[model samples]
Target: MSAIRSATVSDLEPLSQLLDDYRRFYAQPSDPAAARAFLAQRLGAADSRLLVHAGQAGALSGFVQLYPVLSTVSLAPRWLLNDLYVHPEARGRGIGRALMQAAATLAREHGVPRLTLSTQTHNKAAQALYESLGWQRNDAFHGYTLTLD
Candidate 1:
């Protein structure tokens, strides 16, 4: 298995492609330019951590992005595992698991108290993988979102 490392500006092109594909998976239209711009903004703001796995010939196989957040109840820092994606050709190769593990490791290194993520309820495969990694599903609170746009 290839090692997962922090994504840099040099990875923009491939990383943007991966992001585009990931968005498409969620029913979003293809927009490579927008993907690149969004990722570049995140990189520039330094508000998120992006970890990428390289496949054959140094191509990116997968990526995981984390955003720092605070847990008011605990008065401590936590991380939101915002985005995780593995190329279709790279699926079933453990890349996703590796990316997730790397994210956890990064959070630990930063002294984060916890990491949180959410997925579509129908995404059983991702839920299974996360569960296998010891990530527990929250049963105590209901999640709600409002879109202003």
Candidate 2:
């Protein structure tokens, strides 16, 4: 049976490989070293919460990363899910859903009233998966992001 738990610094290597594959799946350049450094910062600095699913010698089968944020008006804590990836070879094995379920549990434990995430407009497969997992479209809101150069 696979188990999910909070990710620590030691899981960086496997988590890095998974992140690299995830980015490549969406057409990003493959760079395992960059992935390693990025994961290192996230885990080392304690700026984000990353959960991993592993079994037998700690193979990272899947992962989800969340960034804690706050609501502007009420100042209530919320969690933004930044990344959710399941290794392609592990697809159809329910690892993705397991990660999400664990994420929700984490949010609850942290006293977060809600969890939020965004996906590319063209990613119908991921949207479907999210909807099936109880996420809904926010027709009343638009998401805008600014990139720093």
Pick by TM-score: which candidate is best?
1
Estimate every model's Cα lDDT from 0 to 1. Answer: 0.95, 0.90
Model 2: per-residue Cα lDDT over 34-138, one tens digit each: 999999888879999999999666788899999999998667998999899998888888888889989999999989988999999998878888899999899
Writing each residue's lDDT as its tens digit, candidate 1 over 1-149 gives 37789999999999999999999999999999999999999999999999999976788999999999999899999999999999989899899999999999999999997999999999999999999999999999999999997
Give per-model TM-scores.
0.97, 0.93
Q: Superposing every Cα of model 2 onto the true structure, what RMSD results?
A: 1.3
Q: Relative to the unseen true structure, what is the Cα RMSD of model 1?
A: 0.9
- Model 2 residue 57 CA deviation (Å) reads 4.9
Residue 21 local lDDT, model 2 = 95
lDDT measured at residue 119 in model 2 versus the true structure, 0 to 100: 92
Off by over 4 Å in 2: none
Task: List, in order, the clash count of every candidate structure.
Answer: 0, 0
